[model samples]
Target: MSLMSDIIAKAKARRMRIALPEGSDERTLRAARILTDGQIAEIILLGQPDKLNAQAKTLGFTLDGIEIVEPVTSAAYETYVDEYVQLRQHKGMTRKEALEVMKDTVFFAAMMVRNGIAHGAVSGAANTTAHVMRAGIQCVGVAEGFKTVSSFFMMILPEFRGEHHVPYFFADAALVPNPDASQLADIAIATADNWKALVGTDPNVAMLSFSTKGSATHPDVDKVIEATQLIHARRPDLNVDGELQFDAAVIPSIGERKSPGSPVAGHANVLIFPDLDAGNIAYKITQRFGKAEAIGPFVQGLNRSFNDLSRGCSTEDIVNTVAVAAVISQAQA
Candidate 1:
């Protein structure tokens, strides 16, 4: 089975509760219908019940088993507001601010995850990434031992040049515009952990740079080298190598010639780019020109499961993200 199909199957088996904050969006409603019909997860949509129902009717679908919650009218609304104030009180957030923030569907959905009302939350369909991520970071918080919350794209490549197809993960593609060595290390570790959780395989991480094994020298190459060292010091068990060019990281003959006997070189399943400039451009190029199927910019390193979607995402994209969040929830639990 394809990786996404496997994820959906896993989600169905787990049957976790996932919340959608953008119930007013047509794509989200359609995705909710698909999730319910397939028994992927118990979907809780946050919005006005009447408006959501009318929208579903206009879209010619039934939200038969889906639960719709009007956030402001729900019994937990005031409680959530109070708790949010406490959570952010150190930042000088008052109940007044918390009340207004809780009215937003994204924050409400994240609060649901925070309070265990739902196992996970997915948004960003009609919201900006910054807004969705702000809600996630503020409400769900970062995982223990993680200093950075990052993202990865699961790239499914087509069989080409007589090689069989396989899935690879590209990291920090949609978040963290520019990362220093420390943050880059955190990104690598987070991506590797999530890759293993979802793919059920050991991660071979290759930290990408323009120069291979000190063939050239620059601050950019130095940053990648330092990040690689930090990853080794922190996670020695991880199979990781760094300061490798793109070809050396993926191509067997070139890898042997350049970085011989390196565990990750030539066999890397998780590619950690130096910066967002490289990662975002590379993933898009691979998707458009290489004809690879890219599934995510899946958010990682959150204590609770909260994912973001592209603003232009399709209904299938939303369904897949919800499935991913469900699997992450199960794994975290």
Candidate 2:
């Protein structure tokens, strides 16, 4: 069976709760309907019930199995405001300011996930990446062991025969512009864990750079080498190697010739770019020119599951993202 097929099937069995804040968008409503009808999740739609119902009817969507919540009118509104004020008080947030921020759908949904009203939340369909990310970072926060939040693009590549699987992962493509050695190591660890959780494979991580095993010399190459050493020191059990070129990371023959005797060379499924510039450009180029499916920018290192969608995403994109989030929520639980 397909990877997505297996994930969706597992999600249906788990019956995870996923809150979606963009209730007025047709794509979101359509995805909620699909998830509800498929019994894939317990769908909570965040918006005014009457407005959502009207939007659904106009779009010919049935929300019979969905729960609609308007943050302004819900019973949890006051409690959520109080909680937010406390959570952000050290940053000088007043009750009034907190209340105002809570009215934003993304913040409201984040509060829901924080308070355990939902297993996870998905947004970014009707909002900017910054807004969605800020809400998740502030409210739900990163998992305990991680220092900061990061992202990964789950790249479903074209069929290639060999030892590795069809899908792969690329890290820090949408967050952490220029990570230091520590952050880079954490990003590798987090991406590796996420790949194992979502893709169900023991990740062989390739810390990518412009050089291959000291073949070239640059500060940039040194950074990757240092980060690779950090990962090895911190997570010796993880299968990872670094300072490798793209070809050396993915091409078996080239990898063998370039970085001989390394376990992760050529067989790597997780590629960690040295910086956000390289990571972002690589994933986009692969997505557009290489005809690969980039299913993320999935927010990693978070304590709870929360995913962002592309602003131009279709209804099917929303559905697939929600399904993936549901699976992650189950794993976190």
Candidate 3:
């Protein structure tokens, strides 16, 4: 099966609950129908029930089996507000502030994930990345031992080195502009874990740079080298190599010539770019010129499975993201 199909199948089998905060969005409502019909997950959509129902009807569908919660009127609203205040009181958050924040669907959906009302949450369509991520971090918080919350794009290549349809991961493309060595290492570790969870395989991680194994030198190269060492020091079990150029990381002949005998060279499925400038540009180029299917800028390193979408995402994109969130929820559980 294709990677997305496999993930969707897994989601169907697990039948985990995923909350969608953009219930008023037409694309989300359509995707909810698809998720419910496919049994991918038990979908809880947060919005006004009457408006959502009317929208579904106008769109020629019925949300019969789906659970819709109006955030402020929800039975768990007061409880969620109390929990939010407790969780954020250290930052001087008051009950009144918590009440207002909980009224926002995105925050409410994230709280649902935090409180176990839903196994995971997906938002950001019709909302900015900053807003979606803020809700996730504030409500769900970062996972223990992870100091950074990053994002990755699951790049499904149409063809790679004569193989058809290979899956690779590109990290920090949608978050973290210029990461220090430590944050870069954290991104590598998090992406590697995500690859294992979703692809069911050990990740061959390549920390990408302009230089390959001392072929060149610069501060940027030094940063990548340091990040590689940190990954080795912290996660020695991971098959990771670094300071490699793009070609050396993926092309077997170039890899052998540039970084001979490196386990990750040429076989790297998880590509950690030196910074977001490289990662963001590379993923777009791959998507456009390489004709690869870029599935995410999915958030990682959160305690609970909360994902963000592009504001311009399609209904299919929402469905795929929900599938990914569901699978991640299973892995976390």
Which predicted model would earn the best lDDT? Answer: 3
Pairs with backbone N, CA or C atoms under 3 Å apart (clashes), candidate 1: none
Estimate, for each residue in 33-128, the C-alpha lDDT of model 2 and write its tens digit: 999999989999999899899889888766897999999999999999999999998999999898899898899999999888999998988999
What C-alpha lDDT values do all the predictions have? 0.93, 0.90, 0.93
The lDDT ranking, best first, is 3, 1, 2
Candidate with maximal TM-score:
3
Q: Which of 1 and 3 is the better model by lDDT?
A: 3
Q: Put down candidate 3 lDDT per residue, 203-311, tens digits, no spaces.
A: 9999999999998989999999999999999999999999899999999888998889999888899999999999999999999999999889889989999999988
| TM-scores for candidates 1 onward, in order | 0.96, 0.95, 0.97
Model 3 misplaced regions, further than 4 Å: none
Name every residue pair that clashes in candidate 2: none
Tens-place lDDT per residue, model 1, 163-243, is 655789999898899999999999999889888888889999999999999999999999999999999999999999998
Estimate candidate 2's alpha-carbon lDDT, on a 0 to 1 scale.
0.90
Flag regions of model 2 displaced more than 4 Å: 162-165
What's the C-alpha lDDT at position 136 in model 1? 93
